[model samples]
Target: MLQNTVSTRRNIGGTEFPILAAALPVVANDPVGDTYWHIRLKAATTHLSSRPGQFFQLRCPRSEAGDPFLRRPMSVYAVDTNVGEIAFLYKVTGIGTTGLSTLVPGDTLDVLGPLGVGFDINPEWDHVLVVARGVGLATMGPLARALHHNGVALTAICSYRTPEATIGLEPFELHGSVHTVYDTDGTSDIASVDSLIREEHARRSFSFAYTCGSKRIVSLLQDLSSQLGFGGEVALEQRMACGLGMCHSCVIDLRRGDTVESVRVCTRGPVFSLGDIVAPEETLSWYRSCDESAI
Candidate 1:
């Protein structure tokens, strides 16, 4: 029996709150690759009610000349109601993230969230599958926790660019079984992720699959879900100029019946049903190019 949490209807998209940086951001150095950081913030109980797959639009401290005005959209990694805190896991990939990395304990940040629709957790699901790559794991963590709390069995597959780049494995293990794959090693060839999904389905089918990662991985899972007869959801990544519905900057094509409609990623999603998403040809080509370059 899945136990539903309190409704967060009042707290959904467009809610803004002031959050205090609870501690100095912690950076984990990957011996073989780039560094990843985790940041926690003191938040109100209202803010802590965020659901899995939801994200925040964080306005970090301004630059020396007060430039880079837009807030950065970050996935909610975990929410701790007990401590009244919410956290995010991110890599310093650009100027905005770099500024976030410089934050110290007690720093104040303007947080606009828990924005976007979160993953839908149904009471009927018994077995669930979660797939993520690299920092995408951050977005999947809350869903894993929610499933565990609701007594649903979980199987998580995480892919990293290198073995050393993997972080936060222990927490996922605490919730359920996990398989880690690295691209640099021969491990990638041992058994493709799709094969594992097929194996799992043969053993005991999953009721639903949730994934957040590269477009290629998401597309693969979407195809697999259709083939195996299971529902699937994906959290998409896109560039955003505004965290609200006002900006069409983060629009993606979504299939509604026979027609494809462009929808804003910030408001309508960062999360969507696999069947509803329509991948553009250019995006597919870009994903293919990335794969080719990696090979």
Candidate 2:
């Protein structure tokens, strides 16, 4: 399978990591809580050199759900270079993820990526903040580890529909403090979350921020980034085909400073500056009525 790998270079923070398009062996695939599956794959060190916010186009195996024509774009959940492994935490939502759910140890999973841009981390920042919910937890997971590795402090505000459905606990706990909010308790409400972020920002004085999962949260953070004078990034949720930009299927209108331009989510980003996004509250997509991710 390693012999089938294809490679290309992508520059992030001035370093180039070869993009991997290979059929890697699944090392572990297991259910998480009630709704998600955590799958690990054995791959070369190069395959695991992915940064947070970057994603892969997963070729789900044929199953009862049938053969899915397009590969699913999944954000990298975790990477372990020491063990030559990479992992993804995905919900079983459609044919693609349903097939993914059937994978087991030693099975080959065709994957194309470490694709797209990743979160831009500023080395000078001493402390940072992250806000995530549901699949957003998977998107933010690797970034937390990278920040921890760099000795940067983190404060995570995690939201979930239920405690049982929550994901990405360990990385949130590493090198930082975590605040859990659940929809059942009503603490995950936008207003309450806005208040929580403001208080935390005042105390920790986070120099930068990052968020994934909810538009309301992104909207809230966008307001704060302006009011508080701290800059941040948001990892957008978009359903894409071609993971590469060739198809232009994931293109979206983006506001950058004073100019508004269309950009490709798979290329320009699944990640963007907090202030650069336009009307996140009105961003009516999972890239529309979407969020079950895995489909």
Number of backbone-clashing residue pairs for each candidate, in the order shown: 0, 1
Q: Best lDDT goes to which candidate?
A: 2
TM-score of candidate 2 relative to the true fold: 0.93
What TM-score would every model get versus the actual structure?
0.84, 0.93
Could you give candidate 2's per-residue lDDT for residues 1-295 as a string of tens digits? 6535566665535566677678898899999977799999987666677788999999998899999999999999999888888999999999999999999998999888888889988777999999998878999999999998888899999888877777887898975899999888888888898899899978878899999746678778888888988899988778788988889888776776677678889877889888877773445434435443221
For model 2 the local lDDT of residue 16 reads 65
TM-score of decoy 1: 0.84
lDDT of 1 by residue, 34-130 (tens): 6687887776555687789888777766554344578888998888888777788888777777777666665666676677788988867889898
lDDT of the candidates, in the order given: 0.72, 0.83
